[model samples]
Target: MNGTEEIGCCGAYCGTCREYLKTCKGCKPGYLDGSRDQSRAKCRMKKCCLTRGHITCGDCGEYESCETIQSFLSHPGYKYGKYRQALEFIRAHGHAAFLNAAKHWTNAYGRYPEQDP
Candidate 1:
């Protein structure tokens, strides 16, 4: 599938997620369809995006300063820089570019070498 289908509203590359397809679908679909994964179902970022009629935070005007996204990214459990990088990439290059670059990602989280700061 095109990697866009696996992009999360919170900027995660679900395509590389260990649980993707096994226990979870990508964030957008899972959020829309009422995911069985409780975490996905209850995701604030997903809820916010859907509520705002946005596919992802990249579509929001407040992306950079959004408290919800900031809270999510800063959560200790989600200390990966890749998530932020993905969102920044989306903002700078658009989803297609992010997806194309992310196609080779092997890990669900963590900075891709090519995107390392």
Candidate 2:
């Protein structure tokens, strides 16, 4: 089920997406210009955050814990919070599961304008 192309807006790998490849009959990754390497098997969201040692957007010290997450939330193609879902889904199903739901801890009891968690 490994893949190179994607259809799901949250950057879910469509090559592994049973539904898209089945329905469309054809599709592939965009940047086929580069050679495929073992390390190439990485998630876009996870890689970016990990570069800062923040595995997820929630781990960031920024006031907008959900800033990067929001831009994803506001994507024109995504109907649901699929990007958020991806974060959650991976934990339960592991790397192979790209269709995961995102879970975050918002300041409900605390006052607004939270700078850190």
Every model: Cα RMSD to truth: 4.1, 11.4
User: How many angstroms is residue 101 displaced in model 1 relative to the true structure, after the best TM-score fit?
Assistant: 0.6
Candidate 2: global Cα-lDDT?
A: 0.38
When summed lDDT is taken over every stretch of 10 residues in candidate 1, the lowest stretch is: 108-117
- Once fitted onto the true fold, the runs of candidate 1 whose alpha carbons sit more than 4 angstroms away are 30-40, 76-79, 110-117
The CA lDDT of each predicted structure is 0.72, 0.38
Q: How close is candidate 1 to the true structure, as a TM-score?
A: 0.75
lDDT of 2 at 106: 22
lDDT at 93 for candidate 2? 47
Model 2 bad stretches (over 4 Å): 4-9, 16-66, 74-78, 99-117
Best by TM-score: 1
lDDT of 1 at 20: 82
